[model samples]
Target: MHELIVSPFLDGYLALRPGHQAGLRLPEHRYRELQAAARTEVPLPTWFAEIAQETWGLDIDGGSARSTLLVREPSDHGFSRASWEINLGCNFACKHCYLGLKEFSGLPWDDKVRLLDIMQAVGVVWFQITGGEPTIDKHFQDAYRYAYSLGMMLTISTNASRLWQKSLLEMFEECPAYRLVVSVYGATEESFDGLTQRRGAWKSFKKGVDAAREAKLPVRLNLIVTEDSADEVDAMVALAERWELDHHVYTNMTPTIYGGPESLLAQSSKHLRERTPFQGCNAGHTFFHADPHGKVSICKVGRDDQIDLMAEGAEGLRKLGGIADKLMLRTGGCQGCQLSGSCLVCRPLAKQFQEAKAPLANYCQHGQQK
Candidate 1:
């Protein structure tokens, strides 16, 4: 296993370890020096050895760190992060699911490997593997292993339904994830199973949670508050505390991927928090999203003018900054809104609310007017 991953991050270079949040920033010249050392199998720099020893207690000494260090080649592209949906298939049918059609289709093994390679070529150092439920995908193990072998720090967004499996636990132990973001539906079996529409799902989730805690895996809980689960928010927080993990509460609901308003009905209006003003992001500029079939988009919510990664490869990413710009513009119902400057939602998200024919108050400042 590699002890450190050296790669180009944002504007400079970074050296980070798997499952560790702290990282060392490397200057451009030093990064090039490390690249040369990696190519020639020379001993690592004394400063690097000292820092590694001081930081992570690694005993690199004056020996060649090349054997245990993964140094990625710098790319012409500025992309440093990406998210890939491994599959849309999931075990539970939750009411607030953003994906209306949770089909289980994904790339074949060969294509999956190729896509990972393409992402690597574009300097994707921070990678996230997500799905309607990634742990249940048949090819998830192979895909995750290959991605880890490439030395990209990994994060998985899962529902925790399969974390209890011995095979998965062992695999996760071998290749530690940076984090496992698990979504929690309800606090108890009765409410949980009822909300997911899957009998015994709550039991499975509890067992999985117990097993994960036993294994000491880095886990975080996402409390998805719906009308049904709203009353159990405190219980959910208490569960996270008992498990000794961090948790985030989400009360807002989004439209389904196909612009259907059904998911919005699950929103707990009483618990809805005010959204911060819309600020620009680095979605397509520094990071992008790829669907299971390799179609690339600006972000998860903004999916227009997708670039087919399987067809264009990494070179196609050059078109994304332009696509992101186009999507940022205020069009549709938003073009005429005078409150656009202070609108809480961005263009892509507002468009969804419009398509759903949601009441303006649900998303726009115009509706909040007296």
Candidate 2:
């Protein structure tokens, strides 16, 4: 018989079969006692015990049940979702783009398919396809079709400019993406072109959005807020409302992973001032990010630390487990800081400070308060 254990942070439950690692989601409120029980090798609370038996069909009282609960560690290559940046080439060059003027030597078409296979093999069900513009990839259709055939639930983050193309729209109509996230730069031509620095981009974007709606595709909008586009925030939201599409607004921005100076200039001071608790990042654990060149990392902002997925493949995932574990463990100036409740600094960005890179003016609030 297999044993069940709760995650140390109570984020989820882990099932320990002899050779396989599976995760189970449980209510957040029950995490404390469940984590304690799993650590001490004691019986689960009555509620979880019943849930395990009924939902997963596991016999809790079998003679082979292990005395010690096997808690799944972060280094254990177990994850259910991932974001793949197909390529770093975008048509529009937004000033506030996090990846500032970066270039990537993308993998060959065959390698892209292989990476998709590895993602499926690793139990990644929810696959998000993102890029400078995913639809612009030369082999975008081939890769999208292959992943769709594998029965993966796919979502795409795109600018929506090329979505109106016949070939791409046909593919979406056939495979039907789980969601289409259209990034809205501005509500009008002047505001849009001002941020993107591309002539006629606003017209192209609106055309693509209209085409997606006509195709009956699942679509949402991401209203990107920057100092240059702040005046258009209300108009952007109204645009989404007119289209009857759900929308989210992103205000905060960060510098490039390599610490580029251009990014510092683009960031908004007011947006960075908003404070939030250090609720811990889930990157490299529950989720992972892969760039165009097959370099995998915990997340885009923390891309400085990475593994070459092409050279190492799944083994690279195992190596990432240790890095993620260390990242989650609070150390250095962050240790025992009372302002942790309001501090926005995370481990990956904190690493930037230790390496003597200039800190974001907003992140300096921590030191200022101390």
Candidate 3:
């Protein structure tokens, strides 16, 4: 099994290992040498081996290193990261989920591999696998293995419902992920199960958490503070500390991806915080998100003008730049709003709130009365 990967990063090259945080920054010449070693019978440079051992305890001087150590061909595709919804299916019935329907559908295995190939071809380096809950996807393991094989660093966002499964844990043990980010709904079973609308969810979540901890897997928690779980926010944070895992607090809930206001009802009015000003981002130019069917969009928040990766392949991404530009323009609802310069929400997000017909105070500054 390969212990290290060399790939083009944002405007540079990085030598990294799966599941490990430390990395070696490679100059262009060093990256080229690794590429050459991969192509020919040349042995890995002593410097590379020493650094690999120092950083990850991996000995690359072994003869197989030339072949096993992945060295990706360079691409100037201008895209470095993407998040894919393995499937919209979930084992849990979290009420606040932004995917309104939570349909359990996705591309067949062959098509899923094709989509991953297209993503790898376009130099997607950092890949995130998500879902209504992703672990349950039939092809998730195969797709995850394939992405890692193609030198993509993977991050998996899930509810920690399936981490206790032996097969999944073994796969993660063999091919580690960049990180497994689990969502923390509540500190108590009554609050958690009630919020997920599922009985016995807290037990399953606790099992998954224990399994992950036992395996020493890198995990982070997202404390989801909705009205049901609002009172236990501190306890939720303590739970993360108890596990000695990193945690992030999420209080602001947005409308569903389909622009439905159902998810907003779960929002805790007391925990609403002012969003940082929109300073813009490289949504399409350098980052994108893919649906289970391989349709690519600029980002999750703005899903218009999707490009079909299956039908059009890597070349399909060309349209994303233009689509991103169009989506970011201060038109539509904010066409001429004098307050838009400091408006917290982006134009696309504002459009969703408008479609949901949410309260005047929900998304607008005037709603501060709530």
Residue 10 CA error for candidate 1 (Å)?
1.2
Clashes of each: 0, 0, 1
Model 2, position 29, has a per-residue lDDT of 55
- Candidate ordering by lDDT (highest first): 1, 3, 2
Stretches of candidate 1 off by over 4 Å are none
Better-scoring candidate (lDDT), 1 or 2: 1
Task: Please tell me which model should have the higher TM-score, number 2 or number 3.
Answer: 3
Better of 1 and 2 by TM-score: 1
Estimate the TM-score of every prediction. 0.97, 0.74, 0.97
Candidate 1 per-residue lDDT over residues 67-110, each given as its tens digit: 86889988888998999999999999999898888999999999
Q: Which candidate is the best by lDDT?
A: 1
lDDT per residue as tens, model 3, 195-222:
9998999999999999999999989899
TM-score of 1: 0.97
lDDT scores in order: 0.89, 0.71, 0.88
